[model samples]
Target: MTRRPNPFNQQAMEEVLRDLGCPESLIPSTISNYRLFVPLLFTELGEERVYQLVSRTRDELTLGEQEEAWRSSIKYIVAWAETVMEQYKHKRSNAPKSDSPDDKQPRLL
Candidate 1:
Protein backbone atom coordinates (compact mmCIF):
# COMPACT_ATOMS: atom_id res chain seq x y z
CA MET A 1 0.00 0.00 0.00
CA THR A 2 1.18 3.51 -0.70
CA ARG A 3 1.87 5.75 2.25
CA ARG A 4 -0.43 8.72 2.75
CA PRO A 5 1.13 12.14 3.05
CA ASN A 6 1.64 13.50 6.54
CA PRO A 7 0.15 16.94 7.17
CA PHE A 8 1.99 17.86 10.33
CA ASN A 9 5.65 18.01 9.43
CA GLN A 10 8.63 19.86 10.95
CA GLN A 11 9.04 22.39 8.17
CA ALA A 12 5.37 23.24 8.13
CA MET A 13 5.24 23.57 11.89
CA GLU A 14 8.29 25.80 11.92
CA GLU A 15 6.83 27.99 9.20
CA VAL A 16 3.53 28.33 11.06
CA LEU A 17 5.30 29.25 14.27
CA ARG A 18 7.43 31.80 12.47
CA ASP A 19 4.41 33.24 10.74
CA LEU A 20 2.70 33.64 14.10
CA GLY A 21 5.65 35.69 15.39
CA CYS A 22 6.95 33.01 17.70
CA PRO A 23 10.33 33.91 19.10
CA GLU A 24 13.30 32.22 17.46
CA SER A 25 14.46 30.86 20.81
CA LEU A 26 11.14 29.19 21.47
CA ILE A 27 10.58 27.59 18.07
CA PRO A 28 12.48 24.40 18.78
CA SER A 29 10.69 23.62 22.02
CA THR A 30 7.35 24.66 20.60
CA ILE A 31 7.84 22.39 17.62
CA SER A 32 8.88 19.57 19.92
CA ASN A 33 5.71 19.95 21.97
CA TYR A 34 3.55 20.13 18.86
CA ARG A 35 5.20 17.08 17.32
CA LEU A 36 4.59 15.08 20.45
CA PHE A 37 1.16 16.43 21.25
CA VAL A 38 -0.74 16.90 17.98
CA PRO A 39 -0.62 13.34 16.61
CA LEU A 40 -1.31 11.71 19.97
CA LEU A 41 -4.23 14.04 20.63
CA PHE A 42 -5.64 13.49 17.15
CA THR A 43 -5.20 9.74 17.38
CA GLU A 44 -6.88 9.54 20.75
CA LEU A 45 -9.74 11.97 20.20
CA GLY A 46 -9.84 12.41 16.40
CA GLU A 47 -9.30 15.66 14.51
CA GLU A 48 -12.76 17.14 14.87
CA ARG A 49 -12.88 16.53 18.60
CA VAL A 50 -9.49 18.04 19.15
CA TYR A 51 -10.36 21.04 16.99
CA GLN A 52 -13.56 21.57 18.93
CA LEU A 53 -11.70 21.48 22.20
CA VAL A 54 -9.14 23.96 21.05
CA SER A 55 -11.73 26.24 19.52
CA ARG A 56 -13.82 26.19 22.67
CA THR A 57 -10.84 26.92 24.84
CA ARG A 58 -9.86 29.80 22.62
CA ASP A 59 -13.35 31.19 22.76
CA GLU A 60 -13.35 30.99 26.53
CA LEU A 61 -10.05 32.73 26.69
CA THR A 62 -11.41 35.52 24.58
CA LEU A 63 -14.34 36.10 26.93
CA GLY A 64 -12.20 36.66 29.99
CA GLU A 65 -9.91 39.63 30.71
CA GLN A 66 -6.73 37.67 30.34
CA GLU A 67 -3.16 38.86 29.89
CA GLU A 68 -2.36 39.92 26.36
CA ALA A 69 0.60 37.62 25.86
CA TRP A 70 -1.23 34.56 27.15
CA ARG A 71 -4.29 35.25 25.01
CA SER A 72 -2.21 35.93 21.95
CA SER A 73 -0.28 32.70 22.38
CA ILE A 74 -3.46 30.68 22.63
CA LYS A 75 -4.86 32.44 19.57
CA TYR A 76 -1.77 31.64 17.53
CA ILE A 77 -1.80 28.04 18.68
CA VAL A 78 -5.42 27.64 17.71
CA ALA A 79 -4.75 29.17 14.31
CA TRP A 80 -1.87 26.78 13.73
CA ALA A 81 -3.96 23.79 14.75
CA GLU A 82 -6.76 24.92 12.47
CA THR A 83 -4.38 25.21 9.53
CA VAL A 84 -2.99 21.73 10.13
CA MET A 85 -6.46 20.26 10.45
CA GLU A 86 -7.54 21.83 7.16
CA GLN A 87 -4.51 20.43 5.40
CA TYR A 88 -5.19 16.98 6.85
CA LYS A 89 -8.80 17.03 5.72
CA HIS A 90 -7.89 18.21 2.26
CA LYS A 91 -5.26 15.50 1.82
CA ARG A 92 -7.59 12.78 3.10
CA SER A 93 -10.43 13.83 0.84
CA ASN A 94 -8.17 13.81 -2.21
CA ALA A 95 -6.59 10.42 -1.55
CA PRO A 96 -7.00 7.70 -4.16
CA LYS A 97 -10.19 5.64 -3.93
CA SER A 98 -10.68 2.09 -5.24
CA ASP A 99 -13.54 2.01 -7.76
CA SER A 100 -13.46 -1.72 -8.57
CA PRO A 101 -16.26 -3.78 -7.01
CA ASP A 102 -13.84 -6.59 -6.22
CA ASP A 103 -11.68 -4.22 -4.22
CA LYS A 104 -14.35 -4.19 -1.53
CA GLN A 105 -14.53 -7.99 -1.24
CA PRO A 106 -12.78 -9.84 1.54
CA ARG A 107 -9.60 -11.62 0.54
CA LEU A 108 -9.54 -15.39 0.84
CA LEU A 109 -5.88 -15.86 1.62
Candidate 2:
Protein backbone atom coordinates (compact mmCIF):
# COMPACT_ATOMS: atom_id res chain seq x y z
CA MET A 1 0.00 0.00 0.00
CA THR A 2 1.14 3.55 -0.68
CA ARG A 3 1.99 5.71 2.29
CA ARG A 4 -0.30 8.69 2.84
CA PRO A 5 1.04 12.09 3.79
CA ASN A 6 0.65 12.96 7.47
CA PRO A 7 -1.51 16.04 7.95
CA PHE A 8 -0.54 16.47 11.60
CA ASN A 9 3.12 17.18 10.91
CA GLN A 10 4.55 20.13 12.85
CA GLN A 11 5.03 22.36 9.86
CA ALA A 12 1.53 21.85 8.54
CA MET A 13 0.06 22.36 11.99
CA GLU A 14 1.99 25.60 12.45
CA GLU A 15 0.85 26.89 9.08
CA VAL A 16 -2.76 26.10 9.83
CA LEU A 17 -2.59 27.77 13.22
CA ARG A 18 -1.04 30.88 11.72
CA ASP A 19 -3.56 31.03 8.94
CA LEU A 20 -6.37 30.82 11.44
CA GLY A 21 -4.98 33.87 13.25
CA CYS A 22 -3.79 31.96 16.27
CA PRO A 23 -1.61 34.07 18.58
CA GLU A 24 2.11 33.61 17.99
CA SER A 25 2.60 32.71 21.63
CA LEU A 26 -0.10 30.07 21.45
CA ILE A 27 1.14 28.38 18.30
CA PRO A 28 3.36 25.87 20.04
CA SER A 29 0.72 24.70 22.48
CA THR A 30 -1.92 24.63 19.75
CA ILE A 31 0.26 22.48 17.57
CA SER A 32 0.97 20.21 20.49
CA ASN A 33 -2.73 19.86 21.16
CA TYR A 34 -3.35 19.04 17.51
CA ARG A 35 -0.64 16.40 17.56
CA LEU A 36 -2.28 14.72 20.53
CA PHE A 37 -5.94 15.24 19.70
CA VAL A 38 -6.29 15.04 15.92
CA PRO A 39 -4.94 11.50 15.61
CA LEU A 40 -7.30 10.26 18.29
CA LEU A 41 -10.18 11.98 16.55
CA PHE A 42 -9.32 10.31 13.26
CA THR A 43 -8.78 6.92 14.88
CA GLU A 44 -12.11 7.04 16.67
CA LEU A 45 -14.35 8.99 14.28
CA GLY A 46 -12.61 8.54 10.93
CA GLU A 47 -11.42 11.40 8.76
CA GLU A 48 -14.64 12.29 6.96
CA ARG A 49 -16.68 12.28 10.14
CA VAL A 50 -14.10 14.32 12.03
CA TYR A 51 -13.96 16.77 9.17
CA GLN A 52 -17.71 17.21 9.31
CA LEU A 53 -17.69 17.65 13.07
CA VAL A 54 -14.88 20.19 13.02
CA SER A 55 -16.49 22.11 10.18
CA ARG A 56 -19.74 22.38 12.10
CA THR A 57 -17.94 23.42 15.25
CA ARG A 58 -16.05 26.10 13.37
CA ASP A 59 -19.24 27.51 11.90
CA GLU A 60 -20.90 27.59 15.27
CA LEU A 61 -17.92 29.30 16.83
CA THR A 62 -17.87 31.84 14.05
CA LEU A 63 -21.54 32.65 14.53
CA GLY A 64 -21.50 32.90 18.30
CA GLU A 65 -20.36 36.07 20.03
CA GLN A 66 -17.24 35.77 22.15
CA GLU A 67 -18.60 36.86 25.52
CA GLU A 68 -15.67 35.27 27.30
CA ALA A 69 -12.03 35.89 26.38
CA TRP A 70 -11.37 32.16 26.16
CA ARG A 71 -13.92 31.85 23.37
CA SER A 72 -11.53 33.63 21.01
CA SER A 73 -8.90 30.99 21.66
CA ILE A 74 -11.47 28.28 21.15
CA LYS A 75 -12.46 29.87 17.87
CA TYR A 76 -8.88 29.83 16.68
CA ILE A 77 -8.49 26.20 17.61
CA VAL A 78 -11.70 25.14 15.91
CA ALA A 79 -10.83 27.10 12.79
CA TRP A 80 -7.39 25.54 12.72
CA ALA A 81 -8.90 22.10 13.08
CA GLU A 82 -11.33 22.74 10.24
CA THR A 83 -8.56 24.02 8.00
CA VAL A 84 -6.39 21.00 8.71
CA MET A 85 -9.29 18.70 7.93
CA GLU A 86 -9.85 20.57 4.66
CA GLN A 87 -6.20 20.17 3.74
CA TYR A 88 -6.38 16.48 4.57
CA LYS A 89 -9.44 16.07 2.37
CA HIS A 90 -7.70 17.84 -0.50
CA LYS A 91 -4.58 15.70 -0.14
CA ARG A 92 -6.61 12.51 0.11
CA SER A 93 -8.50 13.35 -3.07
CA ASN A 94 -5.30 14.11 -4.97
CA ALA A 95 -3.33 11.12 -3.76
CA PRO A 96 -2.87 8.35 -6.33
CA LYS A 97 -4.79 5.20 -5.60
CA SER A 98 -2.83 1.97 -5.31
CA ASP A 99 -3.48 -0.54 -8.04
CA SER A 100 -4.59 -4.06 -7.24
CA PRO A 101 -1.95 -6.84 -7.61
CA ASP A 102 -4.10 -8.49 -10.24
CA ASP A 103 -3.82 -5.34 -12.35
CA LYS A 104 -0.08 -5.96 -12.75
CA GLN A 105 0.03 -9.45 -14.18
CA PRO A 106 3.44 -10.87 -15.18
CA ARG A 107 4.33 -10.71 -18.85
CA LEU A 108 4.40 -13.99 -20.82
CA LEU A 109 7.82 -15.19 -21.91
Candidate 3:
Protein backbone atom coordinates (compact mmCIF):
# COMPACT_ATOMS: atom_id res chain seq x y z
CA MET A 1 0.00 0.00 0.00
CA THR A 2 1.18 3.48 -0.80
CA ARG A 3 1.90 5.69 2.17
CA ARG A 4 0.39 9.16 2.22
CA PRO A 5 2.46 12.03 3.61
CA ASN A 6 1.51 12.88 7.19
CA PRO A 7 -0.77 15.91 7.20
CA PHE A 8 0.92 17.24 10.33
CA ASN A 9 4.50 16.71 9.29
CA GLN A 10 7.19 17.64 11.78
CA GLN A 11 8.55 20.57 9.87
CA ALA A 12 5.14 22.14 9.48
CA MET A 13 4.42 21.74 13.16
CA GLU A 14 7.81 23.13 14.07
CA GLU A 15 7.20 26.21 11.98
CA VAL A 16 3.75 26.81 13.41
CA LEU A 17 4.94 26.24 16.94
CA ARG A 18 7.89 28.57 16.51
CA ASP A 19 5.58 31.23 15.11
CA LEU A 20 3.42 30.91 18.20
CA GLY A 21 6.45 31.54 20.47
CA CYS A 22 7.21 27.97 21.50
CA PRO A 23 10.95 27.77 22.11
CA GLU A 24 12.80 26.20 19.20
CA SER A 25 14.46 23.83 21.63
CA LEU A 26 11.14 22.47 22.82
CA ILE A 27 9.81 21.54 19.39
CA PRO A 28 9.88 17.83 18.79
CA SER A 29 12.19 16.44 16.14
CA THR A 30 9.37 14.43 14.50
CA ILE A 31 5.65 13.81 14.54
CA SER A 32 6.34 10.43 16.05
CA ASN A 33 7.39 12.26 19.18
CA TYR A 34 3.78 13.23 19.76
CA ARG A 35 2.52 9.73 18.98
CA LEU A 36 4.85 8.23 21.54
CA PHE A 37 4.52 11.05 24.04
CA VAL A 38 0.81 10.57 24.72
CA PRO A 39 1.29 7.10 26.16
CA LEU A 40 3.39 8.56 28.99
CA LEU A 41 0.26 10.21 30.42
CA PHE A 42 -1.71 6.97 31.03
CA THR A 43 -2.72 3.84 29.15
CA GLU A 44 -6.37 4.89 28.79
CA LEU A 45 -5.46 8.12 27.04
CA GLY A 46 -2.97 6.67 24.66
CA GLU A 47 -1.97 7.31 21.07
CA GLU A 48 -5.51 6.86 19.78
CA ARG A 49 -6.83 9.61 22.01
CA VAL A 50 -4.02 11.93 20.95
CA TYR A 51 -4.76 11.23 17.31
CA GLN A 52 -8.41 12.04 17.86
CA LEU A 53 -7.50 15.32 19.54
CA VAL A 54 -5.23 16.38 16.66
CA SER A 55 -7.80 15.35 14.04
CA ARG A 56 -10.57 17.27 15.80
CA THR A 57 -8.41 20.37 16.07
CA ARG A 58 -7.58 20.19 12.36
CA ASP A 59 -11.26 19.89 11.49
CA GLU A 60 -12.21 22.74 13.81
CA LEU A 61 -9.75 25.13 12.13
CA THR A 62 -11.53 24.95 8.77
CA LEU A 63 -14.43 27.11 9.94
CA GLY A 64 -13.04 30.60 9.15
CA GLU A 65 -10.25 33.19 9.40
CA GLN A 66 -7.09 32.64 11.42
CA GLU A 67 -8.40 34.33 14.56
CA GLU A 68 -11.71 32.50 14.43
CA ALA A 69 -9.94 29.23 13.69
CA TRP A 70 -7.75 29.52 16.75
CA ARG A 71 -10.69 30.60 18.88
CA SER A 72 -12.76 27.64 17.74
CA SER A 73 -9.87 25.24 18.20
CA ILE A 74 -9.43 26.29 21.83
CA LYS A 75 -13.12 25.80 22.45
CA TYR A 76 -13.07 22.41 20.79
CA ILE A 77 -10.18 21.20 22.95
CA VAL A 78 -11.89 22.32 26.18
CA ALA A 79 -15.10 20.52 25.22
CA TRP A 80 -13.26 17.40 24.12
CA ALA A 81 -11.27 17.22 27.37
CA GLU A 82 -14.47 17.51 29.41
CA THR A 83 -16.09 14.69 27.45
CA VAL A 84 -13.05 12.43 27.87
CA MET A 85 -12.88 13.13 31.61
CA GLU A 86 -16.57 12.33 32.01
CA GLN A 87 -16.26 9.08 30.07
CA TYR A 88 -13.28 7.99 32.17
CA LYS A 89 -15.04 8.84 35.40
CA HIS A 90 -18.13 6.90 34.33
CA LYS A 91 -16.08 3.90 33.28
CA ARG A 92 -14.16 3.82 36.56
CA SER A 93 -17.35 4.07 38.58
CA ASN A 94 -18.99 1.23 36.64
CA ALA A 95 -16.07 -1.18 36.82
CA PRO A 96 -16.76 -4.43 38.69
CA LYS A 97 -15.45 -4.60 42.24
CA SER A 98 -12.49 -6.89 42.84
CA ASP A 99 -13.37 -10.02 44.78
CA SER A 100 -9.96 -11.57 45.43
CA PRO A 101 -9.62 -13.57 48.65
CA ASP A 102 -6.46 -11.64 49.40
CA ASP A 103 -8.56 -8.52 49.86
CA LYS A 104 -10.74 -10.11 52.56
CA GLN A 105 -9.98 -9.39 56.24
CA PRO A 106 -8.10 -12.15 58.01
CA ARG A 107 -9.97 -13.89 60.84
CA LEU A 108 -8.50 -13.60 64.34
CA LEU A 109 -7.58 -16.99 65.92
Candidate 4:
Protein backbone atom coordinates (compact mmCIF):
# COMPACT_ATOMS: atom_id res chain seq x y z
CA MET A 1 0.00 0.00 0.00
CA THR A 2 1.54 3.26 -1.09
CA ARG A 3 1.52 5.99 1.51
CA ARG A 4 0.75 9.60 0.86
CA PRO A 5 3.79 11.84 0.55
CA ASN A 6 4.82 13.32 3.84
CA PRO A 7 3.79 16.96 3.79
CA PHE A 8 6.89 17.83 5.79
CA ASN A 9 9.26 16.33 3.21
CA GLN A 10 7.29 17.96 0.43
CA GLN A 11 7.83 21.32 2.08
CA ALA A 12 11.54 20.58 2.34
CA MET A 13 11.57 19.64 -1.33
CA GLU A 14 10.00 22.99 -2.19
CA GLU A 15 12.57 24.80 -0.11
CA VAL A 16 15.40 22.93 -1.88
CA LEU A 17 13.88 23.85 -5.22
CA ARG A 18 13.71 27.50 -4.21
CA ASP A 19 17.32 27.39 -3.04
CA LEU A 20 18.39 25.74 -6.29
CA GLY A 21 16.49 28.38 -8.29
CA CYS A 22 14.20 25.98 -10.12
CA PRO A 23 11.31 27.63 -11.90
CA GLU A 24 7.73 26.82 -10.89
CA SER A 25 7.27 25.14 -14.25
CA LEU A 26 9.70 22.39 -13.30
CA ILE A 27 7.96 21.50 -10.07
CA PRO A 28 5.49 19.00 -11.44
CA SER A 29 7.95 16.97 -13.48
CA THR A 30 10.43 17.08 -10.66
CA ILE A 31 7.80 15.88 -8.23
CA SER A 32 6.74 13.15 -10.59
CA ASN A 33 10.31 11.96 -11.04
CA TYR A 34 11.01 12.07 -7.33
CA ARG A 35 7.83 10.21 -6.58
CA LEU A 36 8.73 7.54 -9.08
CA PHE A 37 12.23 7.03 -7.72
CA VAL A 38 11.72 7.55 -4.00
CA PRO A 39 10.60 4.47 -2.13
CA LEU A 40 9.89 6.31 1.09
CA LEU A 41 6.81 7.78 -0.56
CA PHE A 42 5.96 4.74 -2.66
CA THR A 43 5.19 1.47 -0.92
CA GLU A 44 5.95 -0.51 -4.05
CA LEU A 45 9.66 -0.39 -3.20
CA GLY A 46 11.59 -0.86 -0.03
CA GLU A 47 14.63 1.24 0.87
CA GLU A 48 17.01 -1.59 0.06
CA ARG A 49 15.56 -2.00 -3.40
CA VAL A 50 15.77 1.71 -4.03
CA TYR A 51 19.41 1.82 -2.90
CA GLN A 52 20.26 -1.18 -5.01
CA LEU A 53 18.65 0.29 -8.09
CA VAL A 54 20.54 3.51 -7.71
CA SER A 55 23.77 1.65 -7.10
CA ARG A 56 23.36 -0.64 -10.08
CA THR A 57 22.43 2.18 -12.38
CA ARG A 58 25.42 4.15 -11.26
CA ASP A 59 27.84 1.24 -11.44
CA GLU A 60 26.83 0.23 -14.94
CA LEU A 61 27.55 3.63 -16.44
CA THR A 62 30.85 5.23 -17.36
CA LEU A 63 31.35 8.85 -16.37
CA GLY A 64 30.27 10.10 -19.78
CA GLU A 65 27.34 7.66 -19.86
CA GLN A 66 26.22 8.88 -16.46
CA GLU A 67 26.43 12.47 -17.63
CA GLU A 68 24.49 11.64 -20.78
CA ALA A 69 21.82 9.89 -18.74
CA TRP A 70 21.47 12.92 -16.54
CA ARG A 71 21.19 15.15 -19.56
CA SER A 72 18.54 12.97 -21.17
CA SER A 73 16.45 12.82 -18.02
CA ILE A 74 16.73 16.56 -17.55
CA LYS A 75 15.81 17.21 -21.14
CA TYR A 76 12.61 15.18 -20.83
CA ILE A 77 11.69 16.86 -17.57
CA VAL A 78 12.43 20.31 -18.96
CA ALA A 79 10.24 19.61 -21.98
CA TRP A 80 7.47 18.59 -19.63
CA ALA A 81 7.96 21.76 -17.63
CA GLU A 82 7.92 23.96 -20.71
CA THR A 83 4.60 22.47 -21.78
CA VAL A 84 3.22 23.11 -18.32
CA MET A 85 4.38 26.71 -18.38
CA GLU A 86 2.95 27.26 -21.82
CA GLN A 87 -0.46 25.97 -20.77
CA TYR A 88 -0.32 27.99 -17.60
CA LYS A 89 0.46 31.12 -19.56
CA HIS A 90 -2.29 30.37 -22.03
CA LYS A 91 -4.80 29.88 -19.24
CA ARG A 92 -3.71 33.03 -17.48
CA SER A 93 -4.02 34.99 -20.69
CA ASN A 94 -7.64 33.84 -20.98
CA ALA A 95 -8.32 34.33 -17.30
CA PRO A 96 -9.82 37.51 -15.87
CA LYS A 97 -7.38 40.39 -16.12
CA SER A 98 -6.04 40.67 -12.62
CA ASP A 99 -2.25 40.53 -12.76
CA SER A 100 -0.22 41.05 -15.89
CA PRO A 101 3.39 39.93 -16.51
CA ASP A 102 4.42 43.51 -15.74
CA ASP A 103 2.98 42.98 -12.29
CA LYS A 104 4.77 39.64 -12.16
CA GLN A 105 8.09 41.44 -12.37
CA PRO A 106 10.21 40.68 -9.35
CA ARG A 107 9.47 43.02 -6.48
CA LEU A 108 12.25 44.77 -4.65
CA LEU A 109 11.57 44.82 -0.98
Instruction: Tell me the number of clashing residue pairs for each predicted model.
Output: 0, 0, 0, 0
Task: Report clash pairs, candidate 3.
Answer: none
Tell me the spans in candidate 2 whose CA falls farther than 4 Å from its real position.
1-67, 100-109
Total clashing pairs in model 3? 0
**Tens-place lDDT digits, model 3, residues 1-109:** 5464564576777777788887665565334456444333434554456445556776565432354555565455556655656676689699878899986645523
Per-model lDDT: 0.65, 0.63, 0.57, 0.57
Residue 24 lDDT in model 2? 89
TM-score of model 2 (CA atoms): 0.34
In lDDT terms, how accurate is model 3? 0.57
Clashing pairs in 1: none
Q: How close is candidate 1 to the true structure, as a TM-score?
A: 0.34
Query: Which predicted model would earn the best lDDT?
Result: 1
Between prediction 1 and prediction 4, the one with superior lDDT is 1
Please give the RMSD to the true structure for each candidate, in Å: 15.0, 16.0, 14.6, 12.8
Model 3 stretches with alpha carbons more than 4 Å out:
1-65, 101-109
